[model samples]
Target: MSVKETAQEVLKKIGGSKNVESVTHCVTRLRFVLRDFSLPNKEEVASIDGVISVIEQGGQYQVVIGNKVSEVYDEVLKELDGSDPTDKIESKAHHKSLFDKFTAMISGIFMPVMGAMAGSGMIKGVLAILTITNLLSEESGTYIILYGLSNAFFYFMPVILGASAAKYFKMDIFVGAVLGAALIYPTFIPFASEGELSFLGISVNMMDYTSTVFPVIVAVWFASKVNMIAEKFMPKDLKFLLVPAIVLLISVPVTLIVIGPIITLLSNVLADAVNAIYNFSPALAGAVIGGPWILMVMFGLHWAFIPIFIANMASQGYDPMMGLLLANQFAMAGATIAVGIKTKNDKLKALSLSTGVTTLFGISEPALYGVLLPNKKPLIAAIIGGSFGGVIAGIANTVQYSFGGSGLLGIPLIINTSGIDNGFYGGIASQIVGFIVGFALTYTWGFKEKSTVDSDDYSGNNTLLNTKINVNDILSGEVVALSEVPDKVFSEGLMGQGLAVIPNDGKVYAPFDGVVTMIFPTKHAIGLTSSDGIELLIHVGVDTVELNGVGFKSFVASDQKISKGDLLLEIDLAVLKQSNFQIITPILITNPDKFSKVSHENNNLILAN
Candidate 1:
């Protein structure tokens, strides 16, 4: 489908534009906040073309659309009520947790500028290399221009963040910029050297706001709140002039006196704490963080560390945090390549090799979710490899001078401005160790091929012609009668007759599998036809579809051929137990009429003979 069609279909599936309170996009997903959480059918949404998956996380319905997310976001905007994203922000009546709001706010502020920020960071890295090698003279006009291009963004970070923050806070963009500019205004910035300045005869604290993160966000939030109150009482005729004037007079001084210094202090504390962690035991810090870094990325939890990374860069001119985790990408690539080399399946080999290439470019998601994760053991190997390399890097005190790619292409970013040093060699050595260990371990024992099911297991029409079948447990859980289920639809045998299970583990396995007929969009349910003609519907929990694919993960695709005991899905029971929904999963024989006797076995197994 075209991008526009995909956008429209996604909108329709999510109860249309009217249901959306607001929408935003990160690198690969379209995030939406809905007025009614239970309005959309997740199964239908996931089945849409161009969508990779659906994830409900951090109070947003995230549609995974891969590289086309930005295009789809634009198309989505065209279908919304207004051109300004702030127009939709007015409808954010839904409540989000403090952490959720903070993360969302930070991401919103930074995402718009990330492209430029990364490019500028890369330029700085490149310049550092040229100057170190004596290929470029720092005093030359060319060097000066390049340095300005690279440094200007970080030098005036407050202004950039202010403009972005205004968009996030639904305030006047220029007003936000002016407030940011006022902090570093040529005449005023010198006062920071003076320590304190008098404003209207009142003592005002002075601090440089350049390259800061928190101050502008707090300032814009305060300004937005002020603008909101002003709009309530001020005449609309005078709002254009008087509202901005009032906001500037109040916000600029408040920010200069209170917000800037406080945030700067807090930022310093945070930076110091990070340094303390590293200083206490750099190896432990590196191993602890780097070992599970891929898992953190998988669950979208890595966003929590971004502020720390930014703060470290702004305050210390370089950060060791990213360098500690740099081995992860290499480890992932190594595992993928190992899988590619060892797998007998041509399709698996092809995918493993291709995704391995992507991992080298610092795009490890493709390899992670597609290759290593599904294989299980290779992921562990990668983790082990990454942790080992991380320890070495920590010992060497490798540092990342700027944000850029995390793979071979970003080697320059680890180069110290002083000259080639132990840190630079440590970074290169870490990647080497990560790759070799990951590859060696995976190739030696991390992967073992599974037995394949015979093609004659079932008929083309999904009916068992002559063979008998036994339906094993779809998951490891306590089996109970279907009538014991709380919901009327399943308790009353309206959907079909079968047993219900209280799962002890989150994984779902295939029972007498032939082909996967369907997977529910929310991934809470599955439809399967056994080789011997038993058609079963494995539903995870009661009313789980309302959760919108949050804790559920489907491994098999629709119509895929599979063997019995193959992993079909994984659910986070912990996340579900917190909700009101019951975790009783009903495994129903949807085509019960095909047999006269469908007996339930005593060993918690279903026998259709």
Candidate 2:
């Protein structure tokens, strides 16, 4: 199918052009904030041709379309809006939940730094192994260089975290980073040494700031809130300077005296609790963590565990959690690989295969986003496999001696001659076994049967059995017949024979067996010529022509034969709103003079087939 066809199908399945509120794109996904999530037939949308997956998280409905998402997003916008992009905001406050907010915060703050953190962690783990094996000396210059590079991320974590937190809070990220840096300055170090110290006559005695987590986050959050208030009250001319001054003055002291101590205490308590649990029953701890590892990945909160692993490695030179996590990685990888092999769609197969490889290399974002999350069965299989593997690793008392990288290859770092002897081979064997079991199970019994044939059945031509079309078969909304439409071109019968459909959603689809004749390069309008010579022009969303082709994507282009009910477009209505375009879509026929009469049968739920 061509891009145009895909775009139309997406729009229709999601409940037509009017249902859309706004649209946007990030990397490989189209992020949409719908005015009404209820309208889109999610199951049908997922089953549409050219779509990879649909994910609903953090109050956003994301469509994963792989590397071509940008191109598709552009086409979708053109279909909704003609030349200008929309700029409208949908109120997400109503949909906000504690879990949703927390996940959003974590994802926004941690995603960007993940690569750097992983790279540094891996390097540090390698250094630990070298030192443990007596292959490097503590004072060696080469070791120091590598160690410094690896240590940089941790030593300056507050800065990175602060920037990410600022972004989450929609505040000035640079200022937040500077404030975080201030917490670790030499001036604060003295407060750690002396019995008592004061900052500007305020008593400053609490937890040490170095290697701290909660202080910067709390401070930045406060700063963001203060900045917002200041921006509103202060005069436009002085707002920038005033906001920063007020935010810093209010936030720094609050952080030093209250936020830092409270969060530090909480962290310590949590750490102590985890340590106690581990001490009591390592196997139980492993089992508990392993069982829910997939959940952590889904919510994107796994980053929180990084500091714990680092602390354990620094204090005791080994951690059991890391070993168990390795099992989790392989389970996901194996499941993804199995799915890749089973898939017949070339695009899905390639994505699954690539993601599987990346999972093996300890980067599972592609797999998590593109494959596992959409296919529920594979994810469940992986979780079960991971848990079983964790049980084995725990029973054997396998522990990792370093804090970097994860998955099968990281096994070497876990083997310490001086530590508990589980033999390197034992850890390796458990991980391999878990991976194989997960792959085999998912391939054989975990998944639903995928479609082997093309979606052409839904895209072929069919003669309308009768001329009396039911408007209710289309969908719910204010109904207006073709003659009632205000546009002269539409009322004068210049377009076509079909009724003028004012969709509640910004979606459109093939009305009958036809061949797409012209898909406006901007993606705003599509022309379909039925096999019976009835021509149709589906101009999606009123005034969406102004979106300048931003969030629209098409599946089929000009001259492609289509059947009734075929998907033609997928639009990001959120983007349309963001670009200040209307969501109401107008379906018109460019060759209206040829038809005897155009009429509406009912006002809701239009059925083309």
lDDT, candidate 2, equals 0.67
lDDT of 1 at 111: 73
Question: Candidate 1: where is the Cα deviation over 4 Å?
Answer: 81-95, 458-469, 472-609
Give the TM-scores of the predictions, in the order they appear.
0.76, 0.61
Model 1 lDDT per residue over 408-491, tens place = 867889988789999999888888888888888999988755322222322333232333333334777777777777664566
Per-model clash counts, in order, read: 1, 104
Q: What digit string (tens of lDDT, one per residue) describes model 2 on residues 1-609?
A: 766777778877776566565566654566665666655644456556667667677655667665566677878888778523354434334367876765555555655676687677677667767887789887899998998998787777778888877876778888888778877776677767666666788787655566555668778988898888889899999976778778888887788777877877776776677677767776676667774787875654565675566556544656767676667778888988998898775766887889887777666656865677656678788887787777777777777765556675576566773532673555676678668877988898875433221122222233632333343333334556555554323432333333455556555567678899999877878888878776566766544554677788888899999988777887776786666454444465444334433333444212222
Q: What is the lDDT of residue 165 in candidate 1?
A: 91
Off by over 4 Å in 2: 1-51, 65-92, 129-137, 299-319, 336-358, 363-379, 396-405, 409-427, 440-609
Model 2: how far residue 572 lies from native, Å:
28
